[model samples]
Target: MIQTILLKQRPTGRPKISDFEFITEESDLTLKKDEMLLETVYVSVDPYLRGRMSDAKSYVDPFKINKPIYSGSIAKVIASKHNKFNEGDYVSGMLDWKTKQISNGNGLIKVDATKAPLSAYLGVLGMTGLTAYLGLTEIGQPKTGETLVVSGAAGAVGSIVGQIGKILGLNVIGIAGTDEKVNMITSEFGFDHGINYNSSTNMNAAIKKVATSGVDIYFDNVGGPISDAVLFNINKFARMIICGAISVYNNTELPQSVSVQPFLIKNSALMQGFIISNFSEKFPEAINQLATWLADGKLTYTETIVEGFENIPKAFIDLFDGKNKGKMIVRI
Candidate 1:
């Protein structure tokens, strides 16, 4: 039987495990021509998934109630009637939160386990990495010697953005929720400096202390107060890449925070918000560059893997708690 988790109820504030329900069904192993059966190997637990939990209008349609939640997953093709994918081929795609999945194999991409760990396709070498790449280069338009500050700096996209900034010879300052994350960003990811937002009483002052020259590029994954602080430190003509707003995703009411328009006008800066699919046309190019960087040892990544399929909901809820240091993945 295939077991799956379904969104049982819409959550208010931070999500709880009670908001999800588990069910089992007779395993659907039947495959028609051009169809494949996949066994989930790794399920991604990301901040963006939080927004999808609501019925609100967004870039992607909200997950329907009583249906299995879906996100990117790395799976092994256990059975296949498709010519493109043979049994034992590993693939990555937007799949359900079930142990077993049946697909027509339309969006699945074949992945090589030898080139990188199968799970890396769910993270660094996949959508997360592409988000950082296209967002930074295409939107932020970073240049050499500029100062870059990234919110949610210890997370999947922010960590990669900071590392890529370093590779581009920019000074990188990161903002994370914990001292541990702050330390990891500077020591492990080669960021220039990291601020512990949880410990700082005056975020603006703290950022000013380190970024004395003001920020030239801000890669923001967390919005709200942290973004307000970053906005106050922007240099003239600075660029802001608005990624995930993890801080306000769980809010039931309209989220309010310090305004950014004044700073945008005063500095003649640019702040652009984007969904990664905005650059879907160039994914092949982005993936090739990220894989090359990984092979060349010019880039590094991290994952906080939770074991077991049943714990998928817990893994996702932990994202709001800042429990993972990097990309959070459920290893089934």
Candidate 2:
């Protein structure tokens, strides 16, 4: 039998397990020309999926009700009638949440398990890494000796962004929720400084204390009070890369924050929202550089892998609660 997860309903705010439905069906191993059968191995659950669950106008269309929900996943080709794919080949792409499925090979790309772990293709060697690298270099335009501040510093992209900042010779400061995360960013990821936002009453003061010269580049992952705090400490010509806003993703009403216009105007700073797909042309270059870094021990990543296909929805919902340390993946 093959099991699959479907969007049971549009979530009101934070997603619930009831919002998803699981169904089981007999396996269909038959494959047509140019089609292949894939057994799901790993699934990537990210905060951005929350935006897709909503019917609101956005970069991507909302996941249809009672339909299979899709995400970045790694799968093995068990049967293939396609010329490009073969049995035993592992591929990665945006795939449905199913134990087994058939594909016509539209967007799937073969990944070598020997080069790196299969789960990594969905993370550091995949979209997550591309996002961090492109969003930083293209928007940040970082210069050596400048101060770089990262919100959600212990997260998948933020962790990579901070490491990349250090690689570029910039002074890196990370802002995380817990003391352990604060310690991990500095101890494991090589960030120059780490601030536990939950322990710090005044984010502005905390950021200012570590970033004494002011923030030259701000990689914002959580856009709420933390972002508001960064606004006050930006240097002249500072570059602010607006990534995901996990802080306000679950809000039903429009959340309020400090107006950034005055800050940008006063400091002559640059702020831009970054979506990874916009920079598709540079993917090969970014992946090459990331792979080189990984092989050369210049880069490292973490993953919180949950077992079982049934736990997919719960794993995704956990992202809101900050349960995972780095990239969250589900292993089947």
Candidate 3:
């Protein structure tokens, strides 16, 4: 039998286990010409998937009720009838949350387990890395010696952003929710400084103290008051890469924060929000660079791997509670 997870209903504020339904059916294990059987190996659970759970229009269509919920996943080809793929090959792409499934090999790409771990393709060497590199270089336009601050600095994308900033000669400061995350960003990821937002009573003052020269670039992942605090210390011509707003993703009503208009006016700053798909043309370049950095030991990544296919929804929900550091992956 094959097990699959479906969207039982659109979530009401934060997502709950009740919003997801698990179904099991007899396995077919059959494939037509130009098709292959894929057994899911790794599943990526991201905060942005929360946005898709809502019915509102956005960059991507919402997840339909009672339909399989898909995200970036790595799967192994156990059997194949396709000429382009062979049995025992592994591939990475957006895939359904099923224990096994069949595909015609359209968007999927073959991945080498020897080059990097299968899970890394869903993280540092994949979309998470691309978002960090393109969003920082293309949008942030970081220069050497300038200060770069990253919100959610310990996360999948933000962690890579901070490391790339350091590699590019920027003074990097990271903001995380816990003391341990703060320590990990600095001690493990080579960030120059780290701040625990949960412990800081005066975020504005804290930011101003550490970022004494003002922030030249801001990589925002969790946006809300933390981003508002960053506004007080931006340099003239500062660039803000508005990535995932995990902080407000589950808000029941409109989220309010300090006005950014005045900050931009006074600083002549630039704030741009982007979806990684918009920069698909530059993906090859981004992936090559990220791989180079990893091979040179200039880059590293972390993953919190959950052990069961049945726990995928819970692992995703844990993202909102900051339960995982770096990428959250379900290894089945």
Best by lDDT: 3
TM-score of 1: 0.98
The alpha-carbon deviation from the true structure for residue 59 of candidate 2, after best TM-score superposition, in angstroms, is: 5.6
RMSD score of candidate 3 (Å): 0.9
Task: Kindly report which residue pairs in candidate 1 clash with one another.
Answer: none
Q: Write the per-residue lDDT of candidate 2 for residues 1-332, one digit (tens) a residue.
A: 99999999989899999999999999767888999999999999999999889874653778989999999999999999999999999999999999999999999999999999999999889999999999999999999999999999899999999999999999999999999999999999999999999999999999999999999999999999999999999999999999989999999898999999999999999999999989999999999999999999999998999999999999999999889888999999
**Model 1 poorest 10 in a row by lDDT:** 55-64
Alpha carbon lDDT at 304, candidate 1: 93
lDDT, each prediction: 0.92, 0.94, 0.95
lDDT of 3 by residue, 128-197 (tens): 9999999999999988999999999999999999999999999999999999999999999999999999
The reply for model 2, stretches above 4 Å from the true place, is 56-59
Model 2 residue 256 CA deviation (Å) reads 0.8
lDDT at 270 for candidate 3? 95
**TM-score of model number 3:** 0.98
For candidate 2, the lDDT comes to 0.94
